[model samples]
Target: MGGYGDVQMIDENGLRMDGRKPGDVRPITIETGVVPVADGSCRMVWGTNEAIVAVYGPMEAHPRKIQRQDRAVIDVAYNMAPFSTTDRIRPGFNRRSREISKVTKDALESVVLLELYPRSKIRVSIEIISAEAGTRCVGLTAASVALADAGIPMTDMVVSVASGKVNDVVVCDLNKEEDNYGEADLPMGVLPNTGELVFLQMDGDLSPEEFKQAWDYNVDAAMQVHKLMVEALKGGANS
Candidate 1:
């Protein structure tokens, strides 16, 4: 978080600086089967954060050692485009992107029935075309959609979202400014139907009550985001 502490992010009406309630997430749009060449793909836009995910797979695993005898391995690469931020980010694997990619792969492996396809691999590539904040969550959420589009069997889809505290108030789906200047951040990946968590992470400071509020906000946001995912898959061909 930034050191700009005096920036007030909440008003007396309990509304956030962006005019949303404490639990309200920004607008979201999702589309599936977007990349023609990939076996499956999804594009999602949350606020100004845009991510595209491509899935290729159950193909023969390569480089012998990485292959598993009982299940397919998931390879994920999370990248941010040069033009995706206010300051251009150089292309390559940075620490932040690498960590996010690892978490994304882990989250996906939890839901996908990988053991069904031994000696195979699944590649999930996430490209951030526009990043506001929570790009990793958006990428993970879209990856689930792409897996579904590919007709891969899974226990359930994961819906990811972030919530944070700014000006002593809890807010859902932090934008770029809030993310940089907020007091705390909690991101989680949840199964919409079961309310089970597959991914979790937090940073900065928050009291117990504040933490609960953030978790609740993420839970509520995930359900709404799931609706968009369903719509996007239905409109895949048209999109």
Candidate 2:
């Protein structure tokens, strides 16, 4: 949460500076099979954030000790290109990346039928080619699609969406500026088919009423994103 509310991001019509309504998400596009060598791959662009995710191997898990006898382990490595953001993040693991990766791996593991591939490793690579505000959400969403593209069995795909408070009003999908100055941010990973949640994170503060509104907004946005994920997979199957 940015926590500064002096800036006026909302206009007289209750529209954001980017002309989006409080409940409207930014434009998004999803595509599959972007990486030829990977077992599964997906490229997703949301607003100005772009994430390319690749899934590889239910291969033999190395270093016998880490191998699970009952279920496959998911290794997620999330990275941002140096040019992905204005700050030029270093091209290696950082605290933020590690945290996001662990959470993402946990969320995906909940939906994927890991028991089917015991003593194997499924690796998910998330590369942030560009970032606006919701790169974490984009990465998680794209990773789920990549996993599906690899023909992994899963109960449902995860749809990651975030809602934030800005100018004392709750809004769905914070843009760069809004995120920098917003009051609160709540990101959730939802299983659209079952309406179940696998990941949840929150920052800043929200009133009970405001929190409920944000949760509703995230669920609604997830449904909308799930539609796109399905279409992208179908398109890939045809192609």
Candidate 3:
């Protein structure tokens, strides 16, 4: 969250500068099974953010410590491509990417029937080819679709989104400017069918009312995103 805060991102009409009605997310597009070499894969674009995810295995799990005797483990690697931002991010592991990967892995593990594939591993790789903020949410959501495309059994898919405050007004799916100049940020991974949360994070400041608004936006956005994910999987089957 940005504390510099000099930008006005809301208008007198209670609409965001991007014309969203405080609860509306930007357009999203999703496509699954995009990488032929991988077991399953998906690509998603939300606003200007784009992410691609690939899934592999239920194969033998490596690294003795990471293996579970009773359940399969999920190995997630979330990375931002060199050209993902206006200023390139040097490739390789970093603390931020590591943390995001860990959290995303945790979220997916919650829904995946890990016990069914003992001594195996499910690998998820998320690559951010373009970013306009909220890359983590996009990555997590895309990973779920890729896993499903791989025919992995799971309780439900995960839908992710972020909401925040700008100019004291809450908004859904904050864009680059909104995120850089915003006052708060809340991102979540939701299971739309069960209305349960698998991931959550927050920073900056939000009043009670503002927090509620942001939460609502994330939930609504998850439902909208879930539809796109399902459509992507269906399209993948036909192709």
Candidate 4:
């Protein structure tokens, strides 16, 4: 929750500030093989946010202390470039980046079949080239595509989306303006094929009914996004 002011984010037409009906997600485009040198890579643009993810290894888990004897570990580094936001983001690891990275790693771990590659490690690098809002969800979703592009084994691909309350109405995806003034945000990661959840996080409050609306919005949005992910992968390894 950023601001609780009486800023109207929904209009008389019952549409969001961005002219979307409450259940519409931001526009998205995903492309794979963006990083030629990496084992796999994907570039995703969601609304005004853009993220590039590169996956490397199942090679070797460096430093014996961090090595696992039976399964591979997923290492994620989520970073925002200096000019990622309107205000310059100071480069380097910060607390917020660390938390997002850890949560992303956790979500990926749930779907990736780590046991297939014993005692190895996979490194996922998430770079936010531009930001408006919901970068974390974008990063996680794009990372899954990068893993698939790299030919990794996974039980299912993850599709992440967020829904929130603004002006007493629940919207499918909050744009920059809505998020800055919204009171609640619920982000989720879904395994589209199985209808299973790999990740869920909430900030602020929602009544049970509001919560269900938001939840359904995310699930529906995930299924839609998953279709695009599959399309991108099918489109080939270029771009």
Q: lDDT-based ranking, best first?
A: 4, 2, 3, 1
TM-score of each: 0.96, 0.97, 0.96, 0.97
Superior candidate under TM-score, 2 versus 3 = 2
Clashes of 3: 0
The weakest ten consecutive residues by lDDT in model 3 span: 230-239
TM-score of candidate 2 on Cα atoms, chains taken together: 0.97
Candidate 3's TM-score reads 0.96
lDDT of 2 by residue, 1-239 (tens): 66766899999999999999999999989999999999999999999999999999988998788799999999999998899998877776589989999999999999999999999999999999999998889999999999999999999999999998999999999899888999999999999988999999999889999999999999999999999899999994322
Task: Please provide, for model 1 over 59-161, each residue's C-alpha lDDT reduced to its tens digit, 9 standing for 90 to 100.
Answer: 8899889999999999999999999999999887599999999999999999999999998999999999999999999999999999999988999999999
What's the lDDT for all of these models?
0.90, 0.93, 0.91, 0.93
Ranked by lDDT, the better of candidates 3 and 4 is: 4
Off by over 4 Å in 1: 236-239
> Candidate 4 on 1-239: residue-level lDDT in tens?
87666898888999887789999988898999889999999999999999999999988898777788889999999999999999998887699999999999999999999999888899999999999889999999999999999999999999999999998899998889888889899999999999899999999879999999999999999999999999999993333
